[model samples]
Target: MLILKLTNITKEYNSRVILNDINLSCKNCEMIAIKGKSGVGKSTLLNIMAGLERATSGEYYYNEILMNDKSINSLSKFRQANVGYISQHSPMIPELTVLENICVPVWFEKDEEKKKEYMQQIESLSMLFEINNLLDKKINALSGGEIQRAGIIRSILKKPQLIIADEPTAALDDETALMILTHFNFLKSEGAIIIVVTHNDIVSKHCDKTYQLSKEGLLLIS
Candidate 1:
């Protein structure tokens, strides 16, 4: 099934075009890597899909529903419930404990039983990410890699249908980057649509397919 579709999408800043007539679609269980040089609008594309940024032209569809300005509230709810985003820098609260941070999104669910179920899932994900030890630790006390793993755990804890990552491995060393990418691969196998915006060649090589962004537009690189 098509999980996301972007048709003739364009983004401009002060009349300067960043993305031009880009079209793409992602299927369920697909792992797509978006690669390009610095400042090539890779992150812009991901942000637009995630509803963090608005497209200047064209349309974005998630699960066959058109996403537009009037659907802002619906988009926000969909993102919080069905999409998980991991940016270059992990957005962890300095004062919150790792477990607390992971469970923060759970409060959005009003169902008491479902909220408790999600908390249990979070604990399992923390263990899977090897972050169980850090659950009680404040975010500020974690090392770079620890925080990054926590971020991944937090994203997956919600069992999102789509996972969008922007240079998620940029702060990690070679081995750690490979490990994180491997985890993403595993998630893809379990039926999540994973889209990663990365400049890393290793990540591109491991992805199911790759797209490159340039001044002209988005092109298939692999």
Candidate 2:
């Protein structure tokens, strides 16, 4: 079953076109990678998927519903509930401690029992990523890799249906990148659709499918 489908997707800035006539379909338990040079529209594509930006032309369907026609408010709600985005840089709040930053996803979770359950899950994942020791430290006190790890933990904490990550492992070492990618696989097994934009081979190689993005569109590379 298709969780996401895009056809004839295009994005343009001024007179320059970044993406042209791109088509993609992703399903449950699938992990896809978008790879390209630094200036390519890899991030743009991921942002489109995450509903952070709109395409210039095309159709976008999420769970068989036409999302392109959705109102701004509807899109925002849908994103908050179904999309987990990890951008190239850490989006953590400098004033928030590592644990607090990681808890952002569950901030509005209403049920007390479910809130505790999610907190425990976050703790387990923090330990798995070896970030548990830094939980009480301010975000600014953490290293680049540590901040990136925290960003990752926040993204998956809600276990959203779609995970759209942009260069998620760019700041991590090879061992740590592999550890994070392995966790993505575990999320996939639970029926999440993972899509990441990256230039790193470690990330591309770990995905079930990899595509190279260009001005012409997205071309399958693996």
Per-candidate TM-score against the hidden true structure: 0.94, 0.95
Backbone clashes in model 2, listed as residue pairs: none
Best by TM-score: 2
* Model 2 segments more than 4 A misplaced: none
Per-residue CA lDDT of model 1 for 125-212, tens digit only, reads: 6777677888899888888988888888778777788999999989988887887888888888888899998878999888889998
- Evaluate model 1: give its TM-score: 0.94
What ranges in model 1 sit over 4 Å off?
A: none
Worst 10 residues of 2 by lDDT: 87-96
| TM-score (C-alpha) between model 2 and the true structure | 0.95
Per-residue lDDT of candidate 2, residues 1-222 (tens digit): 757999999889996888899999999999999888888888888888888888888998899998887888888898988998988687878998999989987888898998988898898999999999999999989989888988888888878889998888887788889989999999999999999988788788889999888777889979
